[model samples]
Target: MTTNKSQDSLQQQLASLPQDVQPGRDLWQGIELAITQQPSATDKAKPKSWVYGAVAASILVPAVAVWISISSLSGPVEPGLDSAALIAQLSEQYESQKSSLLVTYQDKPALTDNWQSQLTELEDAAAAIKSALKHDPNNVALLRMLQTVYQQQIDLIERVHAPKWQQI
Candidate 1:
């Protein structure tokens, strides 16, 4: 049919065309010349400002974030109450209470044999938090965590030595 003949003719024409072709001149010379040239004054000045801005933002963004986080973590301290002094006061109170509780429970045996080990673990955790506090003394969350851990230790000591009926 005429359609088949036209298709064959098109395929023959495509096959007859040269497969390999070359430019009349070397194109790399122009590209090489362009790449080797220096940028104009406007282009140079524009990029410098943009680069400086990007560099400054890179440095400042993290600094601002750190400032915000530290401020928020420390929050607003009460008038005349320093974080370190408050921590020391609370620690002293906790120690006093813990010592008195231990003295009261010295004669009594704990209900569970592993209570001492559990207390040791809590003590270790408290020590780690205290170490962190030394670095970030004003962190309220760490202060609360230390208080909670101390309370847990006290509760553990009291509960372990309490009478069976009282436990219920």
Candidate 2:
């Protein structure tokens, strides 16, 4: 009975609220500016295909960071499957993807200088973990760290190379 009364009261309160609130007159000018600033239709549509990859990459960044931190505190997982082959595969993928991005972006300047620096930092971190893995052989934390860094490198490259419509 109490829930039924509360539901009815909630409905009445919602019905009493105004529904016609609107933006001020200045909002249309910004909308016009945005429309005018839009790039060509072809250019606008090109990035849509890669946008899913970009979205996935964005989501991965936080998960990797959290995983890295958690794994660093915990003792390394047991040596099980062959991490060497996995690291090698990720490294090869990174190299090919990096080269492709470099070729693609050869004519264009990066959106910012910070992305390359960030990639360098991640690369350095991956190298450090790789060096440690050489000693530990199958250290799960190191394997995960190396994979995350490599994945981040590819993601950054894709992001910088892709069409940047939002910049407008």
Candidate 3:
């Protein structure tokens, strides 16, 4: 019963309100004036030069810093430090190390049967990189990749032959 009375009161209040009430003044005139008026030069949005400069500096400063650091670290190449010679020297060392490791592990069976295949794959990759280096003997990236592959092969050989349990 109380809900019904409250609902009736709400309906009465809604009915008493004017449905078609008009504004005291016509709003279109003000709207039209605002729309037709040109914005003042000062009111128009301007690109802030300092903000752009700040943004550019934020990007450019780090880039320039990185380039400078890299250039400084690399320094000028020494005439005697030939890439081919370096590659050859490193390859000789790697082969010697690999041979020694194989000899050390010759009596031990590898933990994984597929380790030799994996090593073969790495050797293939190394061969490809070396071939690439031959075409571009001065390529540092290729040299690094070849070095990494050789290291990986060595690591794989060591890990498979010398299982962690055996170390303990």
Candidate 4:
């Protein structure tokens, strides 16, 4: 067949071609000079790696020893004051002061608009958080929120009454 004859001729032509052809520019001299200019990186890294390991060990050994010593010397810390009772006592104080301030400022002109409304909002938030605490007595976050709202109520009461209202 013509296909088989053409395939055989192409193989014969490929076989007749030269195996190696020389490049016009010389390349060996630059390669030899570069090799002679420096030692292998692996050889240089051997001593450098040993020095780095020694430095790391020197720093880490003392730090680890100090940490172990300090940990062994300290006793366990004491737990803090009872948050529930503390909140209740502070709340009582704030309510007493707030009642007196309300009586004093009942007829006075407020410096800021809707200041009473702000106090009422804070009181509402505190009441809600306190009711939540009654249901979830051991909730830390609820206790913290109740304390924060109570403090806000006290601060609002003091601010609206004392400094500005006293001058008037």
lDDT of 3 at 89: 64
Task: In angstroms, give how far residue 168 of model 1 lies from its true place.
Answer: 7.6
Which tens-of-lDDT digit does each residue in 1-168 have in candidate 2? 999999999999999999998866668888889889968787965657577788677556555654554354357544564556656755765676668667867887777779889888988998898889889866666667776787778778767766456433
Give the root-mean-square deviation of each candidate in angstroms: 23.8, 10.6, 24.7, 25.7
Q: Which residue pairs come into collision in candidate 4? A: none
Residue-by-residue lDDT tens digits, candidate 1, 1-168: 999999999999999999999999999989998999898887765545676687467535544543454354465755565667656766776677778778878998888999999999998998999899889877788877887787788778878998546632
lDDT of 4 at 41: 79
Question: Candidate 1: where is the Cα deviation over 4 Å?
Answer: 1-75, 78-81
TM-score of every candidate: 0.50, 0.48, 0.53, 0.41
What local lDDT does model 3 show for residue 39? 80
Choose 1 or 2, whichever is better by TM-score. 1
The TM-score of predicted model 2 comes to 0.48
> Per-residue lDDT for 119 in model 1?
93
Question: lDDT values of the candidates?
Answer: 0.75, 0.71, 0.75, 0.65
Q: How accurate is candidate 1 locally (lDDT)?
A: 0.75
Alpha-carbon runs more than 4 Å astray in model 3: 1-80
